[model samples]
Target chain A: MANDKSSMQLVANGILKENPIFRLALSMCPAVGISTTVMNGFMLGVAVLFVQVCSSLTISMVKKVIHPRIRIPTYTLTIATWVTVIDMVLAAYMPEAYAKMGIFVKLIVAFAIITMRLEMFACKEPVGASFWDGLGMGLGFMIGMMTIGLVRELLGSGAILGYDVLGFKPLLFFILPSAGFFVVGLMMAFFNYIELYYKRKKGFKS
Target chain B: MKNIITIIIRLTLSCLLAAFVMGIFFVMTSKAKKHNEHVNEEKVMYSLLGYKVGAPVPETVKLYAVYRYIVTDPAGKSIGYLVPTGQGAETGFSFIILDLDGKLIEQKPVTVTADDAAEAESRDKAIKAALGAGKEAVYADDKTIIVTDNGARTAYLLSGKFAGFKASISVMLALKTDFGIRGLAIVEHEEDPGLGAEIEKGYFKNQFIGKSFATLKTLDVVKEPLPDAYAKAMEGVKGEDGGKILEQYKDHAIYALTGATISSRAVTNGVKGTVAKFAYRINILDNVLKEQHIVVPF
Candidate 1:
């Protein structure tokens, strides 16, 4: 809204500045459930990205016609359409992955990030800008999810992306829900530290 | 009127748009989603009865749905009904396919949940306690062993058809002997956020590996009447600490839980009930086999 941020900036911001899980912490449902494995985390991230991008474009194109009272439902309908499509496609072609991801694939309908972008950015923006914003945010979510999943998988399971790495005896506790909080907190703290260092040294403000 | 018309038009347009997109989406993904569901059902089926499953599963078998059919002998006479029953708890449910012939099936324990709340709560607590003590691994302690959990407020029996069902009664058989603990789901009387709640701790339930029904009856922990013949039969099995104590009584008669005797007895009875049910049917089948002079694995 301030500078009509360019597509490149939006993309970079999603990766670092306004990350869905690490920075803004939006779309947590799948983040918690599918972060058990790196492959699951990546697959879920891509699914979210697909839904987010499609919903954003649709919402932007119809922004002028949608009334305020009906806008929320309109956006949800759009998101759910994309989610069902992705869910069905995954289930058909990649049954094993679909099983591993389970209900989280269908849960993208309620992922706040999709609707949030539609309301806060896409509704007021042009189609191109809205598309970029959605893409960036989705990628940011992917990054955050992948980071957490990588750490958890590596420590809790001694694997990364289904490949055995480090071969450390897993701390079984890390795989459970309680350890989820611990892993996410440490990652967020680490992100904050990096952000602070960059800001202090380079005067970075995006 | 114009303002109202605009609102109505906007609402209608959005709804229509949503429906259109959703319809297209469904059309595109329907086949794949159905396929995925089919595969999952197949996986569950494979886990349940692979040995009996002919080399290739028939494409027509719908894994998600439970169907009842009659099981017939090779001679084409009906022997029993194959009933697929599913039971659910708060966490999840399991589907069990049972073959039943009359009174024998009625006596069989089909892994039912507790209708009573008190038993459920205590059983849950016990599971938590045993798991919290870093005892997740369990092994076969001995045949006909009696495992009593003072903390669990329940008891369990290991061996026989009783091992097939899931519930508090399952605590005794679910024990991972290698780890020396009962699985977290079966134990009752576990504490919250304490040693008991740690499902991974693996302690009290693990102690049963070397002990047996005969050993339990003779120990200071319990005082119950068990046949000496049963004791003699179980005398050779050893407990984890490495002694003939467990082996000697591995296959002894029934073992009883002492402090939480009711819970223990329930598990024992539940197991015995399960075995009786299965054995009765098997025996009937055995008799049939003998009459036919047919040799097959029982």
Candidate 2:
């Protein structure tokens, strides 16, 4: 609404400037926890995607009717309810993937990125716009997770998605919790460097 | 006053709308959910029963919410029951299967007959004593299930929760009727990945597989700094049968998974306690089943 940005820019913002992982640094708990394997990250990412989109759409529709003074609670109620629904629905239907994301499903309620979108974007935007924002954020999260997962799994376990890509284990440290933070920080810095480099180039033209 | 009234109305409306949407989803999924849940259970049962890959689909029995059943390849030839335990220590479940004659093979499914319905009521208390008392349920149905061969229970499929170094670890344990561990699957866990979580991998879990149980009552978690010869000797005996491994391993002590000693001990202790309690429960149930001659005299 402020700049009348295109839908694609909104999507790009989640991946680059407003990335829940890199820029905003939200949902770091899961960002580190599940990135141990691509399979783990993929399953959790899908769960987050489903919850993120649904909650955004619902919150957008109800924003007007909801009291501003109580909007935060309302948003929480909406997100938690959606999370339970996703957990049950997955358990009830998709038994295979649900197996991969056992306890992580319940942990989604604690994700700050999911709630932040509901508060910042979904609250003010129309349902359609909010839906796009949710998709963008979810995709960004998925990319971040996969990037971390790919690096950790490949380096730590010498595998990717359980496939033995390397003949043997490379750097075992990458898979540990301590290395989890290291890899994420390095990736965040790498992405930031790219952003800065591009910005300086753009400034030179101006 | 007017503002407060508007606030109340807004909150109430949102709550109602949320309720309405949730109800629709709940009703939509209720039936399919039940059907899908039994799918994983079906696979786990078959595997534990030693039906090799590509075995024919086993016939299944569903008795209300508390019990699960699977009729093996030959129809009506054998039955397996998933006993849901909401009482006793561990407060999970045990898979009991019986031959047509009601003998405990591996795991059996016994019916609650009208004549023994009253006695069956006491079965919970009796069975609870097997798992000990006051244990909370940790593993859910989806977390684990047990299966035995149609002819005889080849193994006791055990699923229990282990308090790992980080989070609770849910594991499926397959123990042969002879107290040998057939398999161990770390289904869900939150341990440190490269170290503690390696318990999920083959090298660690495979060590316990096919190793006989000296006593289910307790297992020693072999601390690190293991002698080289002992470690290599242990690997050579992986999946080897008999009490030799039990003796060599010292009171059925499970060697800690390399640098993940705490996580290793958690699984070792949890599985040991659960199996011992379950074995005792089966013993109690055996006595109770044997007394059918009295027809409720005791």
Candidate 3:
């Protein structure tokens, strides 16, 4: 109902305010599974971004005709199609990444974050707005995953993007899945703190 | 209601469009994907055979089992078999050990968890204990792959995997016709790219070349630099000390990656298990071949 903001704002909001990982807490499995390294995170994020954008655009353009009762199935099928296309493209052009992430790419068809956006945002918003929202959310997710990957790789393996910098691991826990929760928690807290500080400086409720 | 029918039509139309697009993509990529995997398999086979790029690969027939490739020369003489790759427990593999005439000592299921191979019990010792004496080795299954070439039945290509620092690392080992370790390839791995991933490089794999299963079975991952003796031998100029160094480690040593002890050890354990399994299978094959009066060259 509130569609007054520019497309840029919608995209920005997904990154800063409604980030699927840090803000909304959707699709944590992939966010953690592939976040073992910055490169892994970056690659997965790029993939999700493409699927999310394509699915969102498809859903938004067809919203008027989608019967509410059958909407979930329609959107799911839509996302699966896009994911398949992306997987084929990757296999054709980027054999290395295709090999590394072939399974995960197929799994993206079922990613909750992509589905949730189709249901909640794209169905309600216009096509252009939904496209921006998907892009923003996808970018925000990529950044969040990259952040987790950087910390984990640097501490768990003493490397970043697979390159050794520290010469030794500092904390192995950070790279494991359990520690992934902590990275997300810490980032959430940091962002929340920043928001609260700004709120207080503006004389608003913290 | 008419609304229900309308929704059905919309869903059907959308699905149709999506299917059309995906169908086009499938047509474009399916052939290439299958072909790529086939070429890779051929390459792995040739590398194991030490064949040159343009050299002819023996003709092949399918042997259905856990693994699928069986090779024969142009004259229809037996060459070898190719073991299919698979995940066993957790680490990667598809390998093995032995003398031309020696029977497999035994096969034991070895778990290489950090706890089992941890302090006091050297990882190799723990492995020895697991495999020692009367532990009955499991029969050949999908996890272990062996290629029994007729030229030298003692030789084989064995593959295995292990949990590395970050992810699973898969390796292929080529045993020469004379029971010598020949070529090595890291088929797949998800280790940290630059640091842990060095396992795929020439230097690491080359270590296995010229080494044999007997020596590798007792190998330990030493953290120190290559000793002067071994260093000398490695420099292609073997002095007396270098020969002594080689002698010392010939049956038991591997240098850990500069910063990847965990991954290095994992690879060692995975390869060790594979050799053990291969040796056992070769022994079985040798018995059968002997009854048939087949000769495996030394």
Ranking by TM-score: 2, 3, 1
Candidates' chain B TM-scores in the order shown: 0.30, 0.57, 0.59
Which pairs of residues clash in candidate 2, taking residues 3 or more apart in a chain or in different chains?
B81-B109, B96-B107, B96-B108, B97-B107, B97-B108, B98-B108, B105-B153, B106-B153
Candidate 1 is graded, for docking, as acceptable
* Evaluation by DockQ, superior candidate among 1 and 3: 3
* Per-residue lDDT over A1-206 for candidate 2, one digit per residue giving the tens place of the 0 to 100 score: 54376788877877777888888989988888778998888778888888999999988887778888998879877887888888888878887777667678989988999989998899998887888888889888888888899999999989988889897888878887678799899999898888788888889532
TM-score of each: 0.55, 0.72, 0.67
lDDT of 3 by residue, B103-168 (tens): 332222444443332222353454344445633223222322344444223346666766777677
Maximum-lDDT candidate: 3
lDDT of 1 at A82: 83
Chain B TM, cand. 3: 0.59
Evaluate every candidate with DockQ and list the scores: 0.28, 0.54, 0.32
Arrange candidates, best lDDT first.
3, 2, 1
Candidate 1 chain B lowest-lDDT run of ten = B88-97
- Local lDDT at B107 for model 1: 12
lDDT for each of the candidates?
0.55, 0.69, 0.70
Model 3 fnat? 0.53
Model 2 ranges off by over 4 Å = A1-3, A203-206, B57-162, B170-177, B183-189, B215-255, B284-298
Minimal lDDT window, size 10, model 2 chain B: B135-144
**Roughly what TM-score does model 2 have, to 2 decimal places?**
0.72
Q: For residues B1-298, what per-residue lDDT tens digits would candidate 1 score against the true structure?
A: 8888988877777777767866886788787676666555434334222213346754433222111123233333233311122222222211111234432221111232332211334433433343344222122122222222321212222333222122233332422222222322232222221112222122223223343333433333233654444444333234353344434544443344222344444444543354444335434543543454432211
